[model samples]
Target chain A: MNGFKIIVLAKQVPDTRNVGKDAMKEDGTVNRAALPAIFNPEDLNALEQALRIKEAHPGSTLTILTMGPGRAADIIREALFRGADDGFLLTDRAFAGSDTLATSYALAKAIEKIGRPDLIVCGRQAIDGDTAQVGPQVAEKLGFPQITYAEEVNIEGDVVRVKRRLERGIEIVKASLPLLITVNGSAPECRPRNARMVMRYKKATTLTERQSANEDYLRMYTSHPYLNIEEIGFKDLDANIDDCGLAGSPTKVKKIENVVFQAKESMVMPATDHHLDALMKELIINHTLG
Target chain B: MNNIFVYCEVEGGVIADVSLELCTKGRKLADQLHCQLEAVVIGANLSGVEKQLYPYGVDVVNIADDPRLEPYTTLPHTSVMIQLIREEQPQIALMGATTIGRDLGPRVSSALHSGLTADCTSLEIGDHEDKKNEKVYKDLLYQIRPAFGGNIIATIVNPDCRPQMATVREGVMKKEILSKHYVGTVKNLEVSRYVNDSDFVVSVIERHMEKSKVNLKGSSIVITGGYGVGSREGFDQLFELASVIGAEVGASRAAVDAGFADHDRQIGQTGVTVRPKLYIAFGVSGQVQHVAGMQESSMIISVNNDPKAPINAIADYVIQGDVNDVVPKMIKYYKKNTK
Candidate 1:
């Protein structure tokens, strides 16, 4: 089997999981600035999966691509430090407030510029929106097969076998080449950055475009030109205007509300195995679960 | 005007509990909007699903029951849902945020070029005076969910789309009860799209059920230890106490990192969000992210030597002593009480 090229899609999002007292906005939307910006957790899991595949196939190259503001370059650097072969930062002023559809378009264009990849991996969903739509939508835009909630992935010849986590049990699915996988948090944790790789590639590439590198720093990335960051723009990918932004998005938000569930909550149950069985039966009988 | 539609998810030839929850909720929203509530059931052998929806207050049940829909695939499911939405033109649609709902909702919303809100905690009816269909067009659906983690709540509304869509999280809303002698209209339909073999890249060979004893998310009494628990031995005390109570043992994110417990048992933003009835926190300083998950518990008891620990703020009962000392006493008390 030939060594495959893989790309991991990552996003830099506000850590919405830890909203504090100052997290609210005056008008009730989320005060995003109050939250810390971090790399999407599942995306790191996706990167781990990609790195495992690369390890399985020795010569395989793993690439990281992200679309965000300039600070997103930090995630790219983190990816490089972690042994990714290449990185691309798709940053542009035009890409803002892009829902899944528009976000996928930009990512798909960036993926196209990177050339054909055997596997395109992404986190199942970003925590901020929790939409879980971008990975499948990107695959749709690129006209490829998508396997979501992939807990485990294995490649057998030309076929890609994956364990997709469903509601009741696990579904073992097999697809042909050139597929997209959206990894769940259940995937194995990512390996720490290699010490040697970190020393060698700390300044191995120029990504921000705005940064000025010193001579010693410039010498580090000069050896492997392939490791250099490729920043693609809207014009480079030639994305369709109607399919790229708010104009292409059909979903509209009419109103936003804050819900405080003031329920009369109480439970009547004895804490024992027998009591638990009876409680389970009660819940099942009440149709809460079965 | 077209009525509100609820995507009744069925697995193993039975309607999912969340679908009933949505139908019940959708019934209220429809009534608030002054529209009829309709149930849309799409799956294989979905014969008895319509009758079940009636008790939940569905006026009409649309069925797209087919052999191809027997085992769920994205292609067939998305095609069926898109076809139904186009034909019925439902003003509002709701689905549970289960595996199937999460998979199918986005695809259908994308194909229809509409906005969809996922994992919503609340749903509301909005009144918009756009001169379209006056009744249906004037009605809006507001999807409310906790944003920026669970720190703040956000209400999002999609007004322009014909069918307002939302995939609600499981356990967030209450499921409706089914009464006897319930009846509703069921209309069976076929898969309308020309789905080619080329479109589907993957084929499901088999389903394997991996039975795991521990599911911290659904446990009633969750005993979680944190970094302050000191070592794996400290977490073992928590597990012992949990076993005494016939409960599941969980860990804070720090405990999982410290190898004190498995990742599956970790409760927080990065792990499972549990709303257990009785949450016993041992040596855990409550982080905001961790609190987001357990804040809704019926009762919280904290055991930490630090009197001013953040966990004390949220805990209903605070034990100002070392968990190593306090946990054993609690276990003894529990044993004595139970006996």
Candidate 2:
């Protein structure tokens, strides 16, 4: 059996899970600068699945493809440090404010540009949006079958078996080659970065970054061609400008507001046995509790 | 006809609660827009399924009963839904935000070039003014949901899309029967016409779908823990207290993610929306997402060391203490006060 060509889609998202007091602006918008940017957690799980497949296939190669600002290349490097062979950064001003559908269109176009692979794996959803729509939408755009909420994936010959973690149960399904899989967060966490891999790919930079690189780094890029991460922008793809970004997105945000609760004049009570007994007695008498 | 269409999910020959909940909401939206409410159920042995839907004020029920359709596969379901939606030209389309709906909604929306919002907390019929386009659109479906990790609420609209699509999680909307005597027409679909042979490429090899054991929504009193609970053993105290008081145990996403509780026990914007008579929080520094689920509780009592915990703002009783200390005391007093 030949090794499969696999691509893992990843995102660099703000750590919204541990949002701090400074995480939100006074105007109710996310303060991106205050939040630390890291590789989306589920996407890392997807990367782990991709890496496992690569290890199993011996000659297989895993590529990371991410769409965001130039800084998103950080996650690509992060993936390379964890055993990916190479990566591509899809960035352009045209892709700003893209909803799930438009983002899928742009990613599908980039995938085509990278040449269709045997399998495409990505997290079920991005933390920031939590839509869980991109993976299936991309599969639909590329005319491939999708297996979502996959906790485990194994390939035998041209057939791929996936174990999906549904809300209430588990299911094992099988499909042929050329498929897309959206891994659930319940999947195994990604392996830690290898020291050797990090030393080798630490200087990996996209063309945009290369232009802004120091002289010594520029010379190293010439010597080590692999360090030059491929950068794909709007000009490189045949995607219609209208269908690649905010213009192509059908959903529009009409308004955004900070979550505010109607505050109750709460009766503060000390954590004393007396207060506890009284509270319980009061609840029992009022039939609020027994 | 430009009616409201809900893509009902069926499992084990029964319509999912989320789908019925959407039907209830859809019926309301249909009434507001003065359009018929329609339901599309695709699965095996769906005979007389419309009987279950009509009481929700559904005007029409579309059934595609095929053996291969049960145990949903993405391609076939998407094909059936897309073809049906295109033919009906519904002004609005809604679905459950379960694993099946999250998978199928995007594909169908992508194929039709329509927009889809997932896990919407609220749906409303309203008008939108596109100031840039200088256009006023009436009766647009407003898809309201918490975004950016549930710190903010956003109202989304698809002004130009033919069928505005949105997916709501189970229990987010109330399920009410309009009338038991309500009647609806049934339209049986020829499954082969909408789905192709290639659509069955993915085959289910094995399946074990157990009914969810947790009954958070049905519980009258809920005792919940957050990450501050410290460890899984820390949650044992909560369970002990719940058993003594005849209450159900719930957890915030943080606690569940920390492995203190199972995902099914999660309560938040992404999890179950519960409105119990009494909600007691232990060590919960509430994020808006968590509060969104339980704020409707008739009485909220928060126990935490942090006096400024966001949950305390909405809590009717703010008990300043640690769960480790307060939980045992509450359990002791409950036993003492009871017969």
Candidate 3:
């Protein structure tokens, strides 16, 4: 496992779980501007898992990769600030509206371009969409075995052991090597940004960020005396243009809507002996208890 | 319009209960659209599965039994599903939102380049007939799920995609009983192009379980305290009340963040959604996210020091007093009632 290269799939998502009146658009799509763009919580958990592996194997290096509109570079910089060895932002106008399938295609291409990796770690699902398809789908596209809902990981000799979270309980599973692990929030919390790493890469930027942040922050990002930003763009990585974005994506959003639950409540009885008996009888009548 | 595909999941050669439940759900959904319900099972010794579909009202059962289907590898499972959907061209696909179903549904949907709705609370079909006399029975699937912290419902439709997919949460719907008089045709499809070792870059060695003592999902009653409950010691008292009531203990997200409870026991959009019959919320503010999960409970009683606490608005009964004071009295009342 020496010199192992780990690639993490990170995303920039609106803080949907904690949104205000300004957080949504008229169409129900998140207003990314009003809501603070935070690193996807699950992706942070994935980064934590990757960092754990790096800690166990000193020679291992972790790189963060993201494909989104250019503003997504903030997620990459956040990752680098947390001790990732490198960051790659796969940005272009073409990648817009890429669903999980198309997103996985572009990411798999990026992973291939980054060279073969020992492992790929991603959050089980992004909070905004909550589809949870991308991680397993990416592993599928990459032709690697994947462990979903990974709560724990242990490596001994050549064998990599993990605890896969099931609905009932956790299942301790082992995948030999070069596998993908999609972590849940239950995975160990990520370590805080290392001051040394923050001092080293806080100013790192993508070419788009450097060119676009055209604001005062852009100057601060580029000229930060203690940091380094190696700008990598679409051309630095080998990818087919058609396969990288919306054109390569076969699935299109027919519609999106806000989901609400209108629930009606009625009571049976409390869990007293008589009420418990009545509840059991009701369940039996409905053929649910027996 | 054609076949309705059902992913019949199996473990150790035995079909899972949820797959059978989906078959029952699919049978009705397909019937409404005037199509045949086709069950797609991938594994060996599927002979019993086909015979068992009759009671569930399945019209046809498709089996792709092979050695590679063993051990539940995502590669082989999704490949088999993709192959079946491409060939059969199901108008709609359904899978249980179990851990396996949640993992597999999206993979197959993505591979087929179709839309998938996850954790659906309800599903129905609506008609969209043209005004002209030439009317075709087109499939209109409406997938309803909770969103906006469960305060709102989102209905997702894939008007253009074939075999529209939805994964349903567990135990939300009832599975129809097998009718004694029903029978269906079961055909075994040959799979020479099954997934092999070469197709897999990594292989699963073994699966272990995590270490958590409480499972809030299965609890009948949850005694959840909130910020008004004060310190962790107050939470401990709530846990004691929970033990006396034979209920699981839960907390609003605030309590969990305050280090009063474990993450699994936290209820809301970011935590588990529960439908317990009796929900006792002590000192909770009833934020939208907190209410989103438990608003559907059979009974809700809120004990808040603040009468104006948001939780009291939706509660069935609001007990306005300090939770530290009121909870003990409620416990005493419950004990007296039980005795």
**Candidate of highest lDDT:** 2
lDDT of each: 0.74, 0.93, 0.72
The candidate maximizing DockQ is: 2
Cα-based TM-score, every candidate: 0.80, 0.98, 0.80
Across A1-290, the per-residue lDDT of candidate 3 in tens digits comes to 36578999999987765555555567756566776778998899999999988889889989888877777878887888888888777775666767676788778877888786988999998866777888887877776778899888877777888887776576766566788899988888888888987777766766555565658865675466334334344566566766656566544333345433342342422334454344435433553322
* Model 2: lDDT to the true structure: 0.93
* CAPRI quality level assigned to candidate 2 from its DockQ score: high
| lDDT, residue B190, model 1 | 54
For model 3 chain B, give the 10-residue run with minimal summed lDDT: B128-137
lDDT of 3 by residue, B103-146 (tens): 88877876776777777766788744434545543557877776
Q: Model 2's chain B TM-score?
A: 0.98
Q: Which stretches of candidate 2 lie over 4 Å from their true place?
A: none
Who wins the TM-score comparison?
2
